[model samples]
Target: MDFDKIALEPIRLDEAFFHKLPKVDLHVHLDGSLRLETILDLAIKDKIPLGIETIDDLKAILKPGYRHKSLDDYLKGFDITLKVMQTDEALYRTAYELAQDAAMENIEYMEVRYSPILHTRKKLSLAAILESVLAGLRDANKDFGIESGVIVSGIRNISPAISMRLAELSVAFKNRGVVGFDLAGSEYNFPAKDHLKAFNLILSNNVNVTIHAGEAYGPESIHQALHYCGAHRVGHGTRLREDGDLLNYVNDHRIPLEICLSSNVQTGAVADLEEHPFRFYHDLGLRVTLNTDNRTITDTTMTREYLLAYENFDLLPLDILDLVMGGVKSAFIPYEFKRDSIRRTKDKVKKMLVEEAVKQGVTP
Candidate 1:
């Protein structure tokens, strides 16, 4: 399998073929990716009062793929998901189900992230909140052989004091199924620097940090995330193109940008799919990786995200390989483990390319 030769032609694959490729999702939000039926069931079990009688009715309201007026507007759907996710059973179920869903899509690994503070609404202790999700992920790994990790997140609109608490929880769960710490939520008025104290704790303790920036805000938010907060990766860096020097710095430093393409369109980060900076950033040699920010909210999967990149950017098999390698390299797994995963991913992708070439009657 000579991928160098395959790089010469762009491969148009079906969804079924894309499903057979190995994938990673580093930026998926657990609360926003719940299954619709599961949400209804949880609501009934918890007596959460969803106000919808059937799945069709609930589906009409969610309208997962519909375009929103703004990022804030797209976030209203969370209120409904959060309502039913307050109990331990709900957390475990959702976490387990998310892992199952990812596995079905051929995602070999994923980092599920959410704010523990939000799950504490039912007077659930922070440790309980974190543990329940971990337990589900652990069980899923045992059953499906899909490796996973949890990234405890701190919301931006929330106070720094609360972010600090979430950071401490992230530190406490360090190697116990929690891979990293993150700052998520509204990026407009609230800046990443405002959560400096939490980042400081996350840093001093030698934990991985990834922040949501440059989505609602601009390049400055990404700058603050990298410079002030020390993010190893920037989530939804839709606006990093606004600053040239910083863009080069990011490229020079090899910092991975978790690009969520469809989510950007639905959330109004980009006016349309064609306007996404993914092609530009990839052309400029930045380590850009595709992800499903909120699978249900954004109505996407790892396969779908890659397909969009393939069709929209006219990507070849080699380009897909670059994205795959970038994702494995940017994973927060320990050095030796990540190195191994990268190697395995390369082998799997190479084999898949060969299989596809045979099917297409294209000799490499």
Candidate 2:
């Protein structure tokens, strides 16, 4: 498609994109986006020795060119971040700071996912771990005015029965800030069907379900997540581009796909920014949302992700607004909240774009 030849211009960082845009991030991972400085402090607090000490070293750990040979390889970097986040205090602070970071990037709402089961190794019960994360999210909401929802992921490598237990916990903790349930990790070997029992439980309890599929595996994974697991949304459904019928089905069903650009590229899901099917999905009337899958790990933000789309796709303000609205529409929160967010975001974007349009003497 010669995406490299697209006449898209980059939006100035503090100028057009960041200050004026309103963003909704639907697929951010809480554990994957921890701040390096915070990680260092947490490691110090627990006396856990990190091989790389300085911020630069942490950046190298995060951006290791050859380190992430595949999706599994990319996820290995999270081991250190997860290790330092064992305590309640550490979890709370990390979640709270993540919310604050989202706000700073002009994100009105975000759905941050993580596996509480992984954090339970510190003797903290599942409920306790979820509670601590919720507490941080709430505190951040109060402090930064950024609303967020938590999606508890059943690690793909985990046992089906254990995953079912997590789903039970999700259904139990529904209104307590846990918005949905997801299955993640090793997409190829651990198929979504393996976790059908857990998803069935979640479905029986009327919990929202979103699955990570079509990122590594092709359209079959997406099909399983939508048809079998009953996912309302698919995280990183990049491989769906290979299947026209499935892509059409997504649009027909109005299912949202959370597209994480740099993560997909870094993990070798898609080749890079230019080859991303974001524009194709958008043009096909599919509900595609932009996200920073792992903020610190990928060294990105919602603003940067949006800007990347804008520049790489040569998208105008209206296009960016529509993409942002797609995320808001696909959000897991209540309908009323989604409506309000879209309303406010539309007004803000209209006002900003009107100003820019007038300044540039461009017709709206």
Task: Compute the lDDT of residue 246 as modeled in candidate 2.
Answer: 84
Off by over 4 Å in 1: none
In terms of TM-score, the best-performing candidate is 1
Cα TM-score of candidate 2: 0.93
Candidate 2 residues 132-153, lDDT tens each?
9999999999999999989999
lDDT string, candidate 1, 98-206, tens digits: 9999999899999999998998888999999989999999999998989999999999999999999999888999988888999988888999899899999999999
lDDT of each: 0.90, 0.83
> Which predicted model would earn the best lDDT?
1
Model 2 gets an lDDT of: 0.83
TM-score of each: 0.98, 0.93
